[model samples]
Target chain A: MKEYQKSKINRIKRGQNRATYDVEKIDAILDAGFIGFVNYIFEGKPISIPMGYGRKGNKIYLHGSQANRMLTSLLKAKEISMTVMHLDGLVLARSGLHHSVNYRSATLFGTLKNLEDDLAKEEGLKCFMDHMMPGRWDGIRSMHQEELDRTLVAEMTIETASAKIRDVGVNDEPEDYNLDVWAGIVPLKQIAEYPVSDDQLKSGIKIPDHVMRYYEEYKY
Target chain B: MKEYQKSKINRIKRGQNRATYDVEKIDAILDAGFIGFVNYIFEGKPISIPMGYGRKGNKIYLHGSQANRMLTSLLKAKEISMTVMHLDGLVLARSGLHHSVNYRSATLFGTLKNLEDDLAKEEGLKCFMDHMMPGRWDGIRSMHQEELDRTLVAEMTIETASAKIRDVGVNDEPEDYNLDVWAGIVPLKQIAEYPVSDDQLKSGIKIPDHVMRYYEEYKY
Candidate 1:
């Protein structure tokens, strides 16, 4: 599908102009970020935990230690929601009431299930790593058996999702435009700095092309 | 109290060594970023929404349109949780299993209440704006009564919180250090670009000092 079916749970209420249910737009927002905040109810209180996720089609893969509290609680709930956001710029308006930020945010709702089989878990891990940094999985050494055994991998088959984007300049009141106020946007972006070598690296090992390429793509 | 009391709801189970319950440290983490993921329950499914917030002593302030769905739901629940995270770096390890990210993340649990009185609401709005840009609140045009009436301001008095910080280099297995692999950290940072003026601004208005100061402080 081209768009997610709007339901009571997945609809964006306020700022309807900024909302979109298109699957591709939502996927684009999701693909731009690796860390997402996953919500879980703990002792009747809803809490959010930031987790690294890999998206494949409508499926999001998350992995953690076998004994992770957040993961286990979410599994018991049978369903989950995750939100990823990228803050693009600060929209400074003439008046305090009009101040806003330009951002792209996507929230996903899905049914959750554990990927217990070894092959499924491996694929999930690959997706997770590749999502964070492309070409990373093959460049790094493969996971050891014990490492895979202790990790708890879970999949969320996205049932519905929505994305909201606000990318314009200052939106002030017509009357406020006459005032002598400095209003504009200060663009903000997450950038990568130079990589630092580990303290105990082997002497002859050079920074791989894949690593340099990833840095260049993210660098300012 | 200097540190939040440890309890089942606020404790960090997996990475206890990296967790801090200190009030000062947690506040520092919160002050670094204005955006937070606030959790709420929709159709019995816990979901998170990203919102801009302002933090004072032990209180977090959030404001939105009077009809905001997430804010209303949070007020109805009478409790709330928010998470703010800053991704510091990507830790590229020798093995895929050891790969991780360097971050400073804080999760807050609190009681929520509406700021009904104009003074209280104004204070909340000030906190919110000042948190975004230190000196922009006083510089901007003051809020009119109608604008304040249309806005809903809420304050959350933090009851408990936890912060986890991971800033070290790659932590690979002892034996994997002998392998000819490039392991290190690629530092990540959120930066500010030059301000883009609004299209409909008054002719003689120059970029204000406050905006330039903010850009300079955050610029690369």
Candidate 2:
């Protein structure tokens, strides 16, 4: 992990809205992410879209076609900001008015540029694969030069960033706490069920140990 | 589903872009969604935020603290445009260069109003809960009058709307497909895992059939 400098990070100092920072906690939350909800501007309006992504040393990589308006504009822009959020639970406060979401999110802003060469494109693809499945890239076929020519890979450094989180117990106003209202959190999580091997797998091919281990340990 | 006018929906159609859409499809996609990304000018630039939402017959319902800048300004404006999107799959084409995404999205234009009064507020709350969990309101306590007094609800009808979709396989330029590159769709889906019952539940409490049934029958 890179050391975060105060000047390099955006800080939210409001006590009532305190969930917007706490870097170590934020990094772990971001590392657990599978995708990001990318927000951008198009034709002078806002457009936000969910997209798959991977994080590297100090940058996040998201690749897709040049056809995407948001992606193309972002790649050619002066700066871009994107957020990755994990909605951990639904906070059902004692009072209806206080109900909110328990979530951990990280927002990063930086300039983005398309990955331009075969070697770099190949590395970016690995970052994408490893981000989605830690050990699957080496087991799959690698991309060739011509194959790299058609892909559009874009990378944005983690320049100005902030992590926000809210995980407190229900905060019912003092008077409402005695109203006999049900209050707590309804936690949500993501888990993979048993793996279904591909149809073309050889008969002798067994479910890999790591894959089986994930199913055994994670309840879905 | 309301019948959509083709011209209003296909305002930005790109013949070769499968992700570009016509009106009817946009309405269906929008109908399936319960939330939208609201982007409005804040301090001379756009600020996008994810908000809880609902849709009435022809209008969209969104509410928050009346103090929020985006909600207040948007409701008072002549028109505000918003976009909603769902990512379906990561299209990994034969070549990394052509990697794309299969998605369904919609953009709509409308004028909004801040809702008031007991009758409209109650109906709005019902729509919000139903949108969050289709059959959940009946399982929990209903909101009280005073609780409604502190909340805010707003509406925006669909004046002009459009929907776009991309649900195809790799569209590699012909030559790239035969270049020995791995290509196919990496499907993405949202699945509800087994529930983690509330810890404060009465001892020996059993999981309700409706909750269990929802998970069992859910395919994604």
Candidate 3:
């Protein structure tokens, strides 16, 4: 398995046991969710913003209006870091110190490049839309030239990454297992409810196959 | 309603229509989730880490091992920023540019103070546990003095904050409303599944009322 070479930058120091540098594992964490918390230095202070992203191979794609402050700052900085996490469950333990959450999280550091060309922007946007909902790109109306012109798309070539996963039940101290306190796992997940069609949609338009398929896969 | 005074650091530059500085609204967004993405400068580069936190009034509390690199760095910096976001749904629109997500997100800028006293630490830890699951702290075994000594709790006095909320339905372009494209929202939510008792729990110990209450409230 290919692994990202650990450096002082991407190394996990505190919870070394839960850390994985495997490229594929990191990619899986990134693909499981479309929203990532991206950080950039703004006016000498760091701030994080939640952004929707799409990944292809080692490249992550982000887009916004041409005047977006965060995207513009990221481009100027030339490098960025993004994190994605899925909270799997709550680990209730016998002792307060031992309580934790079961989660899968990945952090990525990469260099950014602007997708200024129309073709590149279109491809990036398509990847993004399809990542959010498979086949939705083909179902939606194509973008107009003016719309494309006003959009700014960025491609981040992931240089190094690391992921941490904790999937087990409670890990309380052995001595406390005999205590009367109850402990367990409360599994958590993000689920989709039934689709609500836009009131303004044309009269005969039905929920498409791709959307219903998505709902079926993620529905509670 | 009280409002957070907007400064250059905490002002929302984009999506002005959805931006809110109301303290109540921002606090509501923070209280809805326990995990927050906190940004800090690491080796001159800004990186964001997901951290569990609790809030009381305008103060946010975070605790980790004394040796935690992120927590130490945040203390050294003295001022920090954290963001909490709850994804509500996906907004599918007729055009790619109009696609968005329904979400409630808040970004906070604050000054940090370390909780070194045992009483302060215990109080902070209790708030953290109760924030994750109400009544959990009182139900669990109290923390040992050694545990309190080894834990580092940092309280952030929220100086200013801003939030953006998008809870509406699809807003397709007026001209494209007649198109054959399907547009709508697929509501999304984080839910709790049935709790699984720990394998090591004492034979007769039942799941407590607090755990059952949490499950009943959040179970799908």
Candidate 4:
């Protein structure tokens, strides 16, 4: 959530009856998950790829092989559009036609900037690691030069962004409302289970206290 | 799978050690989940959004409003690149630098054709419904003409596609193998809990026997 003008893309524009453009609401939805499908164009055609990304200081960062198509195209293209979304539940409507999903989605448009220097690259990697596990960065070995060179780190400025959401009861058309059809949201969620420790570790190396903290904090 | 020869795009190419080209293997990976981030571009800019999709024949189908950024941009562009991936586990190597995700992902390059007309839209909707719950199409009411006009149905043919997968032990450099770092895959999975029926269902209408079946038959 950077201090920038709110931007809304027409695609995520809510029609007459559905409109949601709240900033905190958008961040809350995004913080719930880690992976998003990123669609971009390389050489004038569209290429959508699945990627893991993290947000920090009004920017989103992604890393991949420099040889990869989507990343290569994006680098050359300089600009891109991305969406991060989560489907919370399946909305079962009384009228089959109204059946839809209860979801929260955020779409952003931005330019790609490569972090080529060593120090910046380290910070990018730190963001990546911390995103997955908040304080784990201090626990792991720092990225070495060669390993840093092998990865491509791209950052996108969060200039124009908006989040669209739909989370409510099923919208059963009047004619079908009392038809005895079962209707409601079948809540869906993404969760991390208990860690399965590495078998080769010394028998007594217990699960780190920090990792266990998430399990308790997260609602199953 | 379509009879058309499917070529693999080099941009989305998989590394020799990183590739899993088996069609069934790809299908299993795709079928294992329901939601993924979908990225695309509009006006030579990148836009990525997340959406739920289904696969049938040799193509992947996504349905949404005619105004979604990713969907609308994809519809107009016709040609698109898309990927659906799930990170199955974390592959930890003895060398921290070698750690990678044991995941299954598919990237496809193709054109998206909007499903026009009522009959085709109905069929597409059927494909979608059955994807989440088999036998649901027959159990639900058919879509009406107005409903068809309001929905956007599009499919991307799997022309040049490849599945990149990593599932087993860590790939550590020889010198680092004996460093005594604990290593293995931390398997991540989405487990399906017991189904909770809609409250409005008749008291005697217990979970349909068919709905009760998947819980016992599949892991997630």
Tens digit per residue, CA lDDT, model 3, B74-111: 89879889999999999999999889999999999999
Please tell me which model should have the higher lDDT, number 1 or number 4: 1
Off by over 4 Å in 3: none
For candidate 4, write residues A20-120 as lDDT tens digits: 45556656665766565566655555556667777786677888876666776777878666667776676666555677776777766678888998888
DockQ of each: 0.88, 0.24, 0.92, 0.39
Lowest summed lDDT window (length 10), candidate 4 chain B? B2-11
lDDT (10s digit) by residue, model 4, range B125-190: 777777776765665556677777888888777666677787776676666544434455555655
Q: Per-prediction TM-score, chain A only?
A: 0.98, 0.86, 0.99, 0.88
Among these predictions, the greatest TM-score belongs to: 3
Candidate with best lDDT: 3
Q: Native-vs-model 3 lDDT?
A: 0.93
Model 1 chain A weakest 10-residue run by lDDT: A69-78
Runs off by more than 4 Å, candidate 4? A1-11, A14-21, A65-73, A202-204, A215-220, B1-14, B36-39, B65-78, B92-96, B174-184, B193-206, B214-220
List the TM values for chain B, per candidate. 0.98, 0.85, 0.98, 0.85
**lDDT (Cα, 0-100) at B40 in candidate 2:** 68
Interface root mean square deviation for model 1, in Å?
0.8
Q: Against the true structure, what is each candidate's TM-score? A: 0.98, 0.75, 0.99, 0.83
Better of 1 and 3 by lDDT: 3
Worst 10 residues of 3 chain B by lDDT: B68-77
True contacts kept of each: 0.91, 0.13, 0.92, 0.31
